[model samples]
Target: MIFLRYILLPIVPIYYLVTWLRNILYDFGIKKSVSYNFPVICVGNLSVGGTGKTPMIEYLINLLKDDYLVATLSRGYKRKTEGFQLANIDATAESIGDEPYQFYNKFKNDILVAVDANRNNGIKQLQLIDKQPDVILLDDAFQHRKVKAGFNILLTTYNNPYFKDIVLPTGNLREPRSGAKRANIIIVTKCPKDLSEAEKNSILKQVDPETNQHVFFSSISYSNSVISSEATKAVEDLEDFTLVTGIANASPLVHFLGDKGLKFEHLNFKDHHDFSKQDIIELNKRALIVTTEKDFMRLKQYESLKDKLFYLPINVVINDEVRINKLIKDFLKIKL
Candidate 1:
């Protein structure tokens, strides 16, 4: 893999130039972007995936759902269906992507969730609803420059900050690091629980945020129990099991489970991987199987594994959350 990355170095400049030109066109208004009157906050990343975007979106939903009519708009990646579609009782992971489907499963009664590759069209369709959302949360739509969000929250993992990386083909970045300037808030996700002040200062120096951007750090907090459709079990009570993960990065989760002195065989797959029938046949053999909440969304559809399959829930533990919550609320207040 390292050799392949080095071999692909020549293609990096071409990728960078293309993305740079696109951003320039948008920046100069050569390509117009639609802006709405109501609040539309975007949570996205400069790098590919695994920056805890879903958790961050859920955090915002939790923060504002009680006080405001919250709705989420996503591209509905990997879904069988296409175009603007609203989440309802018939929704499934295969219908609206895993993350958005997870959001609907959790917040169906409290918020509206919809998916469309064309974010501008999605927003317009959402506005046409009888009960319009007071605020719309754009999930993973930063590079979708066609629609301008009121607040942009860009996330990067602490271990692999975008500043230290180059563009795609050689590195993980989707655009130039300068593209981070568009974000109103920059969050360093997957930080250590005991991250020191000096370390934070070092990262801030590398980040070099502009005058308008606010930087924050967050760590993943794992739940004490693993949940399944049938029952919930305490993490400490789990025996030998199979750990399946189809996420961009599962290192943090592997480390978390290791720290708990648990024993399990890990079956790591590609991010957003679609499980084959044979995959289910193999997984059903295990006495107990553990997976991430997102993966559980897809796996839960199979009837054979319902009794043994369990997923560990995780949330982002933002440092100085009170301040971050205030910042989000303040932004919404201004937009309203």
Candidate 2:
């Protein structure tokens, strides 16, 4: 894999040039980029796979939902549906993609969730709905340059910082490291809870954050194990079972389980992996198969493994809550 990545390094320049040209067109009004009247908070990452975007979005929703009418808009990555569609009473994981569908189901009564390949059009459609939302949260949309967000929160995994990684085929970065400048706030996600000032300074040096941008660090907080939709069997106790995940990054989950004094066997898969029947059969051999909530959304459809699998839900816990809360309050004050 390392050798194959080197073979693809030559095309990095081409990727940079194409991205530059595209942004320049939008900047110069050669291509259109839309901005909505309501405040749009975008939670996205610079890399291709997980940087904990979903949990961060959920955090924001929990923070602001009580005071404001909030809605979530996603590009619906890898969904079967095309154009804009509101997640209705009958929306499933397949219709709006797993992440958005999960959000819809979790916050069905409180939030309006919609998915569209075109970000601007999706926002437009959402605004047209009866009792339009006061604010919109754009999920996994940092690189979607067509929609100008009010506040952009960019996440970079602690293990794979964008500065350390190269573009596309060479590494996981979807855009160049300089793209960090586009964000108003930079969050180093999946950080160790015990990260120190010295380590923080070192990472800041590597990220080279802008003078105007604020940087924050966050870690994953796992909830107690719950029964899988397919299986009615109680997980009994997370400490007794092995953990299995089909997610982009499993380190955070593994660490969380370890902290809880749980001994688990992790089976990691690529991001958004479509679990097969064979995969289910193999997982059944274990006493209990524990997975992330995101994976559970996709795997629940598999009738074969529903009874054997259980999912662990996680939340984003920023270490410096005082500072984060102040920053958000200031931003909302200015926007409001």
Q: Estimate each model's TM-score.
A: 0.99, 0.90
Q: How far out, in Å, is residue 15 in model 1?
A: 1.3
Give stretches of model 1 more than 4 Å off.
none
Q: How accurate locally, in lDDT, is each candidate? A: 0.95, 0.82
Question: What TM-score, to 2 decimals, does candidate 1 have?
Answer: 0.99
Supply the TM-score for candidate 2. 0.90
Kindly list the per-residue Cα lDDT of model 2 for residues 1-336, writing each as its tens digit: 989988999998888778778777877889987876668988998888789899998998888888888899998777888899899987878788889988987888999999987888888888888889888899988889889898999999898888888777788877777788889999999888789999999998888888989899998876654667744333335556666676777877677668667676777788777666788778767776777787777877766666667787778899787887777767776776
The 10-residue segment with the lowest total lDDT in model 1: 314-323
lDDT of 1 by residue, 76-171 (tens): 889999999999999999999999999999999999999999999999999999999999999999899999998999999999999999998889
lDDT of 1 at 120: 96
Clash list (residue pairs), candidate 2: 230-306, 230-307, 231-306, 231-307
